[model samples]
Target: MPTKPPLIHVLHPGLFTTVQDLGRCGYQRFGVSVSGAMDPWALLVGNRLLGNPDRAAALEITLHGPELLFEQALTIALTGADLSPTTNGFAIPMWTVVAMQAGSRLQFGTRRQGARAYLTVAGGITGPMMLGSLSTHVRSGLGGLAGRAVKKWDQFCVGPAPRTAAQSIGRSLLERYRPRYTKSPTVRVMPGPQSDYFTDDAVQLLTSSSYRVTTESDRMGYRLEGAELPHRASAEIVSEAVCVGSLQVPSNRQPILLMADCQPTGGYAKLATMISADRSLAAQLAPGDSLSFRMISAQQASELFRSHHAELDRILPPCCS
Candidate 1:
């Protein structure tokens, strides 16, 4: 008798779960939103732990994690938010690879800390990619399991295990690489293209005061409520290309920190952009989380980005396959 292919059956879909890679690049020019993993760094780290490509598709589990039943033996890695993962009702640690037996059940308990988690199997998630990415843009119905969140009874076909002869089982990340989930996270930012439109007071308020993430927040953007940042001139700006992390302020003065699913172009005045190094951290922030920002020079931001990737390269498992 022939054996069935490996399958991950979803018993219960958690809150806002989706399949995401690094996101669809080069499509923003055509007005396509780059809907990818909110915490791309976590996704990459999970993939690297499994020796998969940096951008292989993985399950982006949100606030309330899902309940899954494995139908075949497999190796997996969990990264990003600590949602208290458990296999066969036993606790499992994050940032480490673990092997699971067939028929084992995976579940997550109350969110102890952090808001997102990435689960990567030894082989990547087998799915169709739209615009070169397996990311799911829920609003437009683009990619990943018919462009929707995995639901109850959904069965996902996982790829083959690591092709390498020597697999790094039980491997773990160093202390420094492990993510820290806190109530108050200080995010770094750089002046945006429309920084000058805001009054000096607005910029100062942005850096000096603490903002609370609002319930309205989503993959599109994080709506903050705090000190109003008044504009020096008209709040309207030419419909210009907008990037993830753009801090857009509308007439109301509250800043909208755009995220992975933001529109390709926006018309609001952008005062600053959260630096790439901190956006992944920011992605882990949840509603009511106290968030603050620190401004950094352009050179400093560039160095941080380069340094982050360099550090990942150093810690990533060898791609023997």
Candidate 2:
């Protein structure tokens, strides 16, 4: 057999690390979850730094980041939470590309603010895609490296960097490109298909109460603890397809926001759906963090989503150009 290509080995798996791309869409009909990067913004920014496509698979590290030893030279970028990343005792800049030599060690410390960080390699991390995506859905064993969290001694191969010279982004662009973690996020929500099932007071509480994210949260869903939302209908609704940001209200009246790894369908009555634009923001929320939802009309939600896409266009260079 031919000798296998060299691969970067995981020295320390940090808090949580998973392989993610844009996501596995269009397979929901087959009951596959759209598993993807939790912090899509970070994933995109990191990819751009390395001149890679937005949909490329990268490593999504949560809370504490990972430490790896590269088997070959490669260009990489880090975005999202500041885990105080350093390479072989030298600090690496965030939202910018840096070159890593073979055998060099990369380490990430505890996070300063947000929960997840996205690390993108130049040509993106090469991996087998299940259901057309490399995103890991541990619960269902659908994608990624055998469908689970990255393990120590696991090696990953990276492709070559772009032939064009790496361009440095201006400080102004850097400031504009990064995600804002300084302020608490106010997520936008749309009244659900079953909103009328809940009392008006419950609707008020859903928007007014400050809910703290419980430690029970994960890639599957965010379990919140706060004011109970009273549903006028005591009976269960038939299970239906659930998407990212579906706020499902269980029998106890507590809301759980379904996430990237959530099941394709759900039985719980959904009270609201967070707009697609804010899904990335919702993913950065950690346990003990407080969040509030503001209701918006569908028309307004569509406009906001368009505006976000426009902003992304401004940052990324044209594909054909």
Candidate 3:
């Protein structure tokens, strides 16, 4: 008889555990949010560490993390937020490949730094894909494990372990390449499509003052409490295409930073848009955490984005394209 396939048994589901990949792209015209890993660089690093493709599906843990029991021996990697991960009662290190024995339980404790983390197995997680991706867009119930967070007792069918996965178990990323999660982070931004709608003072306040992340924040957007961004005219705009990192100011003047699971379109005036390079870092911010924005020219932002990806590629080159 053939051996059964390996599985991941969820013993305790944490705050918001979901399976994610690179995310769905090119569907925003019909109003589709690109829901994926909060930190794609972290996910990519873990995937590459395990000899998997950069877009391999992995588990994305937010704030807290879940306890999972592996049904078979496999190598894994943890990246992103330092959520105090442990395996079978022993603490495990992040940004490094760790070996898990059959029936071993991986768990998380206190959230020391970042707001999210990624758990990448040797061959990544296998599941039904939607729109060519496996990311979870919970608001619309589109992807992931039934388009929702993993529940207690839930089990996931894992893919075949990578051939070189065992050999890379002890490998780890260099210190410089690993990201540092801070309670207060400064992110770079550029003029938005509707930047002119906001007064110069509003833009200055945004860049000069810090905003506190509100509890009401979620994958959709971060409700920031800070100096109100006064608009030049009406606060409303014709519902227009919005993407992650859009700093949309509404009637109350508070800015809402659109995130990974933000709606495809919004009707508020955006004062600025966080650059793509800094957008993922926005995910590491937790409620009560404060963040400041620094305005930069579009050219500078584009150059930074390119340099950022080049560094990420060096962190962990994919075993295959």
TM-score of each: 0.96, 0.93, 0.97
- Residue lDDT tens for model 1, 121-216: 887887887889889999889989999988999888887767741275787787786878787899999888888998887778998999999999
Better of 1 and 3 by TM-score: 3
lDDT of 2: 0.81
Q: Write the per-residue lDDT of candidate 3 for residues 27-97, one digit (tens) a residue.
A: 88888888888788889889988899887899999888999999888789999999999987899999999
lDDT of 1 at 23: 93
List candidate 1 segments past 4 Å from native: 1-4, 317-321
lDDT order, best first, reads 3, 1, 2
Per-prediction CA RMSD (Å): 1.7, 2.4, 1.2
Of 1 and 2, which scores higher on TM-score?
1
How much lDDT does each candidate structure score? 0.88, 0.81, 0.89
Model 2 residue 99 CA deviation in Å? 1.5
Q: Against the true structure, whose lDDT is highest?
A: 3
lDDT: worst 10-residue window of model 1:
159-168
